[model samples]
Target: MNTVATPSEVTKGKHQIDLIDGSFTASEAQDLVVPMLTKKINFHQIKRMSLFEKNHKDTCAPDRDRILELEEAKATVEDIFLQAKIEGKKVKMHSTIHITLED
Candidate 1:
C-alpha cells in the first residue's frame, strides 16, 4: 500500500505517510509532530554578520564595554538596513573612504 503525499498535506500540518521501499505508504503512516525552527533572516543581506561578530570578538579581544559597543553597533547597522529596505534603497559597506574639499 504505497501512497504519495500532496504538497498541501505536507505543508498544512497534516500527517504524512512514511516511505517504504522508496514509496510512501499510508498504512505505515503515523501521526507525527514535525520539528521546525523558524527565524526571521535574510541571509543574502547579512550572511557575513556571523563572521563579522566572530572576528571582532576574537581579534579585538573586547572588554565588557567594548563588547557592548560592538553589540550596539550591530543593532544600529541592522536598523539602518531595515530602514533602507523600507525606503527601497541599497546599502553598501566600505572599509575606508577618503574625502577631500578643495577651496
Candidate 2:
C-alpha cells in the first residue's frame, strides 16, 4: 500500500485534491518530478558505509526505499486522477486518501 500526508482539516475517510488535465508515466514522475520535489523538500540523505562494515540489513535498502517513495507518490497521483474522472471533481496535484475500519 502507498502512503501520503493527510491534511488536518480533512476528517477520516475524506480526501481533497486539485484537478488538472494530462497524464504522465511513472518513469517521468520518478526521474523528473520526484527528483525535483525531493530536492525542493530536502529529503534525508542515505548514510554511507565502509567496505569492511555492513551497511543496511537489507541489501536492496537504497533502491527499495526510493522505489517505495516513488510508488506511494505515483499511487497518490493515480488516486487523484481516478477520483477526478469518476466523481467529475476539479482536483489537481494534491489529494487525500482515507481509510476506514469496519466494526
User: Where is the poorest 10-residue window by lDDT in model 1?
Assistant: 30-39
Task: Encode model 1's per-residue lDDT on 1-21: one tens digit a residue.
Answer: 766757665455424333222
Candidates in order: C-alpha RMSD to true structure: 22.3, 11.6
Compared with the true structure, all predictions reach lDDT values of: 0.39, 0.48
Clashing pairs in 2: 18-91, 18-92, 19-91, 19-92
TM-score per candidate, chains pooled: 0.33, 0.32
Cα lDDT tens digits for candidate 2, 12-36: 5545443323454444333444455
Candidate no. 1 TM-score: 0.33
Candidate 1 Cα misplacement greater than 4 A, ranges: 1-62, 96-103
RMSD of 2: 11.6
**Residue 25, model 1, lDDT:** 24
In angstroms, give how far residue 48 of model 1 lies from its true place.
23
Clashes in predicted model 1:
0
